[model samples]
Target: MSKKSTIQVEKVNAHIVNWLKTYAENAKVNGFVVGISGGVDSAVTSTLCAQTGLPTLCVEMPIHQAPSQVNRGREHIEQLMTRFSNVTTIEADLTAVFENFKSIVPTVPDLDKVNLSLANTRARLRMTTLYYFAGIHGLLVAGTGNKVEDFGVGFYTKYGDGGVDLSPIADLMKSDVYALGEYLQIPASILQASPTDGLFGDDRTDEDQLGASYDELEWAMLEEEQGKSADDFAGREKIVFEIYKKLNASNQHKMREIPVCFVSNDIK
Candidate 1:
């Protein structure tokens, strides 16, 4: 879709809700478990799941999370629970668990490497926590990643945020995700908040690491879809396109199906 392309939120919302319900039924799961990050993607996905009328767990797994981020997460869950009878809010402070994991792992020489590893560990810990609940409740772990992050740029960490039983918004672009969020009447704070993975203790926004805004990234994706070359653009636009290409290339492994080995023997 073009930058100007719009989504029919009502139709898309209904489709996602139905898909969640059908998928959970087919999987023989009782409900869904979602990590509520207080961002538009998670808010929209959780809202859709709650509309399914199945038991939905909005778990806030905060590990060294900023106070503001934690508050937003809690408030969003509270709002969701108040609105949906089947939605429930839960908090799992995995800070101590993360610290324990860090203590056990062999220390790398470089601080940057150690910090990056720690950030990813936080996500994996949250993933593990989500599954722990899912295991007992027989629910699927619903992912909040959008199309640009999941397929285009592969922004999520492998086996971290990437580890999920289902993804409800993986097909929608970031722009479309926001549109759906607005349609759902999600709290203005979450709708207006900058997106973050909540893995980094420093609280850097996604765009901070991405080197481009979601709009620019989405536009580059559209350019790719239209067979437009980056060279066709000039100045800052070209730079943004280059950043998009670089990220997509670097994270390609995360975007593809895991490689496996197959062997066959022939009799002599």
Candidate 2:
């Protein structure tokens, strides 16, 4: 955490906690459930949920060939959950889930896409698991999407990882997430580890997939926020825009509600 972040961390933390509480109460939810992938976004979200005094579940769903890094997710979540009244941990094995799609998942040539599909499967499974538990436990599925992922590379699966009862960190960028993590005094080791999804090998990372570091992403996104023309990513800009379009077009339905009409209920 930097000097600037330290100053605003407390306020940001409080704001998000309050936001989740209000959203939950209004939605008639018991608390928040999150899929913790040992990533920064979910880490920040889980901490804020704990600080919000809401029951939170941080699940780690790992796939095949995953490394010891997968264990970090559980440890980090356990540490964060210690501060809350009720925080549960779950291990939803994705090896079986991925097996269901193993045959067809290999069509993509690039390792990134194949891993994305695998990771996406795990994400959807995690979301489904959240709903199953939330329904039984009377809680809500709290999405951990940050603005950089949500807005920039459009970094999320459609109905899969993107499904949520509510999103608390949707407005903050990737960098701000780390800021909140620090204020909550989350473990330093977890805070410093490279942000990743634990999808493929330990090497599979969100930064590598997005083609930019969180810092650079923050700078580029902030420029867009200021109503300025998009910043120059130069050679990578084409691929970046391509990714943005693909995710935007494919996930548009997730961001929309089904249209419905009343059967002349105007009963005047």
TM-score of each: 0.96, 0.79
Lowest summed lDDT window (length 10), candidate 1: 259-268
Q: Write the per-residue lDDT of candidate 1 for residues 1-268, one digit (tens) a residue.
A: 1364398999999999999999999988999999988788888889999999999999988888888788877778888889999998788999899889878889968998988888888888889999999999889999999999998898988999899999999999999998888899888898788888878887799999899988899999889889888888999899989899999999999998889976656632
TM-score of candidate 1 on Cα atoms, chains taken together: 0.96
Q: Residue-wise lDDT of candidate 2 within 101-193, one digit each (tens)? A: 676644767877776666677667777787887888888888888876776656777666688877888888776778787777767777888
| Candidate 1 colliding pairs | none
For candidate 2, the 10 contiguous residues with the lowest summed lDDT are 1-10
* Candidate 1 Cα outliers beyond 4 Å, as residue runs: 1-5
**Local error of candidate 1 at 34, Å?**
0.3
Among the numbered candidates, top TM-score falls to 1
- What TM-score number comes out for model 2? 0.79
